[model samples]
Target: MAGRRRSGGWRALLCLPLAGAFSLTALSGCGPVPAPDDPEGRDGRAVQRMLDQRAAAVRERDADAFLATVDRGSAGYLAEQRRVFRQMSAVPLRSWTYRLVRTGGFEPARVGGRSLAAQVELRYRLKGYDTAPVVSAQYLTLARRGGQWYVASDDGVVDGKRGTEQLWDQGTVDVVRGAHSLVLGVGQDRRVLRAVADTADRAVPVLGHVWPQEWAGRVVVEVPASLGRMAALLGASADGYRGIAAVTTGEVGGAGDETPADRVIVNPEAYQVLGDFGRRVVITHETAHVATRTATSASTPLWLSEGFADWVGYRTPGRTPRQIAPSSPTPSPPGTCPPRSRATPTSASAATPTASPAPMNRAGSPAA
Candidate 1:
């Protein structure tokens, strides 16, 4: 049987309206980001400036500038911050920005100076590889020192929530660049990353033939050491992506820098279980997302995006819809199109409309 898809996380978010999924990306486009309700109130604007400086430092690769944003008082976090900065040396970054979502998310105990907690949204794009930024949440606690607010720590707890775990947070990042793909992995062997790159490279050209549009024509694949870490990279619970082969992450209607490019993240266990043919289908399926992202938007509807990708994937290796019908089980559900049969003409009487459309998980394989 073919793999299944999902009805959660990336699939759902990617298709949401511009004001919904891509709302936080206000600063990404030509428009100005909405100022905080009280920009000049209680050091809110100060914190925003600090975040701006931090983003610039990352893009410029200036360690000193990056460290200036940290509060020296938090020794452990400071050291980890340094380590994370150094770890990013090999990964080429095209852009990085921080948007302060809100403040007072958590009230931290004061020690050296006055402190306040805030939730900040972090956005970054890999150079030459990402058109849109991989968006993540950062729970931060800032301290006032010498009348200036500094990032005290990122381990802030608001309703037991902390900053989202990034790939660098897990371990050292290893990069493998292909003609049409860039593979980033944590704690993965070179050969494994190579295989991912090779698979993605093969899929890109094939995808172009079907999806004739002006797209990146490339993909970025992230392979973490385990399934759990894969979930972490996506800031999702493992349950949402578990048992799935792979998932594509991206945004729509992005003519310029307004959205992030498509990413093909593999589920180690599930993806590895697939045979060669299955892997090709999965990779090609996700590559199609990269190719068709800007061509369609939230207005296109979920079924069109998913069903089209699935069709393109299954279409590759020269398989016809007739050949695929047998492997796909159609449960008896009310009001479904009747199956074609030699004994009877196409009629509702013989139709087994037992199931709803495949839950729109937008997965490359069987959903969890």
Candidate 2:
């Protein structure tokens, strides 16, 4: 049997607290003294400023500037920070940003006579390889030394201790670049990788023609070696995603903002079972999600979203309604279309339906 195409919705996942994930030693240094209001309040502002400075440094790609915000007193922490910067520098980045997702007001602890420690949630994205930026979250430790704040430590695990591998950390990756698309794969068969690249190349132009003009035409596809690795990328468990063909994920920007980075991740096991035509159809459908993600919302009907994707994927192909419907063991009723089908005219001049359509339930089934 052919594997089913799955459409996974995008949403933020909160997995664990920051302190439980990693350990860091308190950092201390010397700086100018502050006025005597609430010392904790002043330290909070300083920590915020430190985070802002660190974010700017990443965007600027300045190694020295980025390190200035780290605790200089901790040699081991400084070395780790330097290594991270070096790795980031080697990658081609379109943009990088970090925002503090506060769990609560900063809880300051007096570590020593002059040193302090606090915790905050950090949300960050490093957009590279022309795909949607992989959004990552971590709980971080900040310290006050001298009179300025510095990042003391962070839980570098992308998702949690269980998900220690980031995209870069996944063994060796081979990148296939096209005019408007980038395909990355790890431990994948070279033949399959090339096939995915070819499919994406063809799908991009079709998507450009079919989707709204406002969306950026670029697309990124990731083919992980195994379902376990793909789940790590998604910050989920393998069991939760079994039998899914592909899923599109990324942050949705607010109105007037461009769509945030989006990625189409393929299920290696499920995708491998598909024939050539099925492969293209699945790729085009997921690419449609990448193209239309910015304009889509929770309120958008699933039929419209999935139907439009199917429409684009099946367009110009000589496939019939029966061929396009989801495979089932039992036969479908004659002349009764699939619940999700939106009939398209056989030709431009074909007659249109004049009657009002029946209401559809949340599952896309016609209301009785």
Please tell me which predicted candidate would have the highest lDDT against the true structure.
Answer: 1
lDDT assessment of candidate 1: 0.72
Q: CA lDDT of each candidate?
A: 0.72, 0.59
Tens digits of per-residue lDDT for model 2, 82-187: 8767654534566655554442333333233344333343334434444344445544556668778677666433222321244555556667776667777878
Lowest summed lDDT window (length 10), candidate 1: 350-359
**Model 2 misplacement above 4 A:** 1-40, 60-90, 103-136, 145-148, 156-166, 169-174, 185-194, 251-259, 320-368
Task: Tally clashes: model 2.
Answer: 5
Error in Å for residue 288 of model 1: 1.2
Candidates' TM-scores?
0.74, 0.62
